[model samples]
Target: MRITLKCLLMSCSLLIAVDASAQIPTLAKCTRSANLLACVDADGNAYSVNTVGSTIYLRGFEVIGKRYWAQTSSRYGQLTFFTGLASDGEAWVGYSRRVGWTTINRFSSSGGSSAKFTCSRIAGC
Candidate 1:
């Protein structure tokens, strides 16, 4: 019984660590420029987002390539949803923002990826 309990605890701890690792880090900082919102994630990834009328334009600078997505926003009460396709039309990206929390989702042939972050504003960029 004792050995079994120890193994179970170890398995639980390993599962918790794996689950935490799968979570994406929040955006570290953000700044506004006119209609554009620029931010950097805790992982040092950079993003530029702009909204004009109902359309949302997102640009991301990743380690390998630059990605651009253009989506439209729909508002339900205080929540706004942005959904659209990538520049090349090979994938789709969606974003939802409520209050100061934002969730981003990307769907592609490989799989779907997601991240959650707090939308924090900083002065002096």
Candidate 2:
């Protein structure tokens, strides 16, 4: 009877630990594709984003990629215009306040070049 009681207690403790772990907050994720940034919160809400230096700003619902640059920061490469209310959303973009940049392949407006890429996500939403 003592052995059975000990096993029951152990099982209960394990279950409680698992439940507590699940309750912990998880890191957010952000995916970058060409000129667009899509961030998903821990609760799974999607939003558009823009990054300048180490700061990320949440933008409108949709982003239009007029052009993309390769292997360079957007600030130096070209002028990017963002339209819509700048609001703070739940999602975070790539290690908040860290210096990181992504390059986008931009083709000439005349369709002279075509750069194709699939969207990929990185941690720290």
Candidate 3:
């Protein structure tokens, strides 16, 4: 009976750890100004977005190297879609609107992860 209890506790602990690691981080209190969007995640990690010509770039937090996203929408559209690949070859896709939130997804070899930010325009974009 003691052996069975020990095994059950160990199994439960392992399951808990896996669930915690699978959680996706979220960004809040985002502000957009001109060509840049700044945000802070729940864990207090900072992230920013910038546009150079027609390419969009995301930096900070889990980013390990510079990656540029290609725009996939018409310039006249209210919403924009972007896709890119991380330095480590992870696929990323994101979308945002002129007056709403932005959502980004990363497809990694070990499953995947995502982040959503509540965005507000600040002017001069």
Better of 1 and 3 by lDDT: 1
Q: Which parts of model 2 are misplaced by more than 4 Å?
A: 1-23, 51-57, 60-125
Best TM-score among the predictions, by candidate number: 1
C-alpha positional error of residue 36 in candidate 2 after TM-score superposition, expressed in Å = 2.2
Which candidate wins on lDDT? 1
The 10 consecutive residues of candidate 1 with the worst lDDT sum are 8-17
CA displacement after TM-score superposition, residue 115 of candidate 2 (Å) = 43
For 9-115, candidate 3 gives per-residue lDDT tens digits of: 22211111111354663435678898887765454444566766655555544322333222222223555555444334555444554544332221212225554
lDDT score, candidate 1, position 52: 72
Estimate the TM-score of every prediction.
0.39, 0.24, 0.33
Instruction: Please give the distance, in angstroms, between residue 36's alpha carbon in candidate 1 and its true position after superposition.
Output: 1.1
Q: Write the per-residue lDDT of candidate 2 for residues 63-83, one digit (tens) a residue.
A: 222221211112333323211
Query: What does candidate 2 score on TM?
Result: 0.24
Clashing pairs in 1: none
> lDDT per residue, candidate 1, 20-98, as tens digits?
4556534347888888877665555555667676555655544233544433455466555544544445443334444
Clashing pairs in 3: none
